[model samples]
Target: MSKLERNEILLLFDVDGTLTFPRTVIKPEFEEFFYSKVQPRATIGIVGGSDLEKMFEQLNGKKILEKFDFIFPENGLVQIEAGKEVGKQSIQEHLGEKTLQRFINYVLKYLSELELPIKRGTFLEFRNGMMNICPIGRQCTREERNMFAEYDNQHGVRKAMINALTREFADVDLTYSIGGQISFDVFPHGWDKTYCLRHIEKFHNFEEIHFFGDKTEPGGNDYEIFVDPRTIEHKVETPDDTRRILTELLGL
Candidate 1:
């Protein structure tokens, strides 16, 4: 970890488990800290796998977002500043729409073959810059989400799906990670969370950049960013853990 100096550090945060529980709103205490400590002391940015719409929901709408210096949505495929879109990169730009469509169809077909025991709704979610596929479907309730999540951990269902996808689409350039309770973030190679740094650097400078994320372990979405030399990464288990760490970092 690098020495902390006010105004000399950029703090990047992952949304799901770092700022809030997956698909949940940010806790009020942490939101207060963000407004009090982080926003005033450091360059604030959020790098997340979810789309801007989801980010807004997790953050409890646009009020919290306006406090940040920058925002990276869809794993940094889109960048925003002051509530306005600044820049964007699309997965279709790297892989043609036909190719992406093919991959989506292929995964859907694979899911059909599995015939998993769950009420399904919209197995494949296309986010323009990335895809999040949930075998149990995206429309699941919180309890149903938990049910599938438990089953997935026990069955290695996502791992099997990933293995099949790699073998069948060997010619395609793609990257994916198990995101949240029951979904996969599928995008072009190197479009992981680390992709945001290059864009954020063009606007701000920091001697030491720190990142907070839950999935910093191997084969996880935050792994690439955690391992990057440019960031001093901390693996947090939940949003409260993130808040606790931040409190220490800020010496509060």
Candidate 2:
């Protein structure tokens, strides 16, 4: 494909699988490409459901994190700079504390009801604007993660969770989607990742913006932006795929 025309473009990425392996550091070559190629050509930002701490785990270091012009953590609920928080918005603030707490309680109960074969610690994680619910828990080791992943593939546990929550919270006006491979992200209606567009437009100017993500299916976290008309979107499969896409997109 011909290189995208050079211009003031905003290249936004999803961190977990798009930028690096889930819960892992960026590949060395991918890191080199970001610094030597991508960053110099276009404004870059990371808009992800993971909190800043987890995002840093994937980036590997503060120096690597600093390369992006913006980092929209917790699904664009906050923007950070130089290890300082510059802006923040909380979905629980809008949803009401009582309601959010109730939702959490319901999720916990639902997971217990499933009575799956394996369970790890820290099943649900609350972030600024969203919460990640994992049936198998977030603290699973790589081997355990793979085991649950196989079971989930066959049982569609994540999808079942999504459906259960959607129906249970139908009257509450919320959104739910499978995030990455193991969990579902639940937030107030309209708080999907596309929420970043409003903040980005308000703070910066660009002729065109591009988004790359691994999960762009109908019920995936990146689906909202993938379908949005305001931004051009690219779908990638893995970190290596991301590197190849960026290399070609940036003409590296």
Candidate 3:
């Protein structure tokens, strides 16, 4: 880790399980530390994989968002400014529409024709310029959703899916990310926290930057952003840790 100066940080935090409690939003100490201690000293931005609506809901809407000057929402696809969306990047940019459509249609066809004891979630979720696909069920309970993740390990479905697609489509690249229980965040081969931070960092030149998140483990969602050389990682375990990390960094 880098024992860097606190004020010279451009802090970025992942919301689910990091700032907000996992599965639900109930983190008071983090909220207090964010709004009271950290928000004033350094520029803060929430870099999460959640959709726009869910992002606002988790953050208590525009009021909380207004605290930060900018947001890297939708897993770094959509850039929001002052509560208004300003830009977006779609994973499909790497794939032609016709080609992507063909693959998506084929997946849907196979899913409909074949019967699996374990069900799947959303196959395609299109929003803005981006298109997301969850090989399992969408909007299902956490238990129902978890089946998909476990399926990846037991049946090797997730890995197999990526391998099959990559083999079939040599010109296209397909990758999978564990987003929550029932989600596979398919983005460009290089769409990750580093890339996301590159985009966010260009706009704001901060003196210090820190990252607070949960899924930093390998193959977990926070892998990309957590290990940034300029970032201070605050692990999500107890609210006290979040507060302590922030206070210690800020010298509060």
Clashes of each: 0, 0, 12
**Every model: Cα RMSD to truth:** 1.6, 2.1, 3.4
Please give, for residues 1-252, the per-residue lDDT of candidate 3 as tens digits.
245444456778777766766556646656776888877777677877777677777777768557876687766778876677777776566677887788788667755754445665566786543445566657666776566567666876655555565666666665556656555566666676566666666766665667888777765677777776867677776455666677777677
Give lDDT tens digits, candidate 2, residues 11-115: 899998898887678888888877788887887889998888878778976764567777888778887644567788887788898988889899889888887
TM-score of each: 0.95, 0.93, 0.79
Show where candidate 2 strays beyond 4 Å: 1-7, 81-84
Could you tell me how far off, in angstroms, the CA of residue 52 lies in candidate 3 after the best superposition? 1.3
Q: Hey, what RMSD does candidate 2 come out at? A: 2.1
lDDT of each: 0.84, 0.82, 0.67
lDDT of 1 by residue, 1-252 (tens): 355666688889999899998889998888887888778877788989888888888998887467887788988989887678888887777788799779878987888888666866888877767888888888989999998889989998888898888898888988778878888888888888888888868877788889999988876889999999999988999988988888888766
How many Å off is the CA of 176 in candidate 2? Answer: 0.6
Candidate 3: where is the Cα deviation over 4 Å? 1-7, 92-94, 113-121, 146-157, 237-241
Return the clash pairs for model 1, or none. none
- Winning candidate number (TM-score): 1
Please report the TM-score between candidate 3 and the true structure. 0.79
For candidate 3, which ten residues in a row score worst on lDDT?
1-10
